[model samples]
Target: MTDRAALQHRLEQGIATLGLQLPAGAVPRLLDYLDLLVRWNAAYNLTAVRDPAEMVTRHLLDSLAILPYVTGSTLADLGTGPGLPGIVLAIAAPGRAITLVDSNGKKVRFLREAIRSLKLEGVQAVQSRVEDVQGQFDCITARAFATLADMLGWGGHLLAPGGCWLAMKGRRPDDELEALPPGFALASMHSLAVPGLEGERHLAVIRHAGAAAAPAAC
Candidate 1:
């Protein structure tokens, strides 16, 4: 099979394993986005994972693994290099408004192209630091961006009242959870299982102490 075909097959299997019900044509669009990333990465060095098959597993699947926990109509992905969950989530949930924030000019340029080429509505790529990003979102996502305390310290203001912060980590970070900055509380810690991926993956769900309570499971 050709590389795209093989990647499509693997993506289908992975989405099935995750039990996600995506809209029609979503998978194909996602594959096309991956193709763009691969093409851009050749010069920009976007991601370390060069292989498209591995990108399906490590980037696409890994990002979509958090779909179950994503709620609300607006989301901001801080430090969204190459738009991991940001771009992927925008494709999966086109109705929601997604903002991909990154300080890197090259990555932001790539993100803008992806948004334009994909014809993705309600999605914008902002070239700015996490702290400088304005507007509160109902949900915020950060993938290995920084420690829980640090992420909150920088982008905490961007989360709307009652909004939730979903931080993706490689392993359970008990220490970071313990050191959570004041005014924020740990809502939950979920162990994520990305299909075909080895090693530990965890999602730290956090919320403001004064914010309204979150629904169960997020």
Candidate 2:
């Protein structure tokens, strides 16, 4: 059995280490989400990180590491397998409207249950290819989803004018940056420090070429 209290302590410590001041009850809600993910992951193999304690740092903190860069009232997470940053973001920022998009049916089902179980008000799950998702969002996130070129190529239309795309990557994607399609430019790149996690974690902040640039440092 997973030790819920221990997991919650680890998550809380990580949140403080990141210097994030979430709203009341956000911590417990995040822990609840973690528990749900762990339970669902057991049978469905939703994520590679099976240990709930490891999920605190690998999943929760890794996702929350990008919270500062996420802007706008509406956000969409593309290729959101098992609702990594999508659900985590929703729990942290209750005011923002978040949509989780994925093509995998099993993952979508888990996302739906997560939303229901968490009682997240402004969150929704959509099972559709990233290219086919409708409507525009002020912010879009893609976590190791695809090559930057192809990710922007397929989901470019979904980012509203003046919006930004937060691409979660393992390292600075120099080659992919060179291949960004027309009308898009690299705004900034942030080296994320996710507590208890090793290896490189980078957040590539991209925006329309014509749009005002995001703050240079994030």
lDDT per residue (tens digit) for residues 97-176 in model 1:
99999999999999999999999999999999899988999999999889999999999999888888999999899999
lDDT of each: 0.94, 0.91
Model 1 bad stretches (over 4 Å): none
RMSD of each: 0.9, 1.7
- Per residue, candidate 2 scores C-alpha lDDT tens digits across 1-218 of 25888888888889999999998999899988887888889899999988888999988999999999989989999999999899999988888899999999999999999999899999999999999999999999999889999999999999998888999999889999999999999988889999999899999999999787564432
With candidate 2 superimposed using the best TM-score fit, by how many Å does residue 75's alpha carbon deviate from the native? Answer: 0.5
- Top candidate on TM-score is 1
lDDT of candidate 2 at residue 20, scale 0 to 100: 94
Worst 10 residues of 1 by lDDT: 209-218
Query: Among all windows of ten consecutive residues in candidate 2, which has the lowest summed lDDT?
Result: 209-218
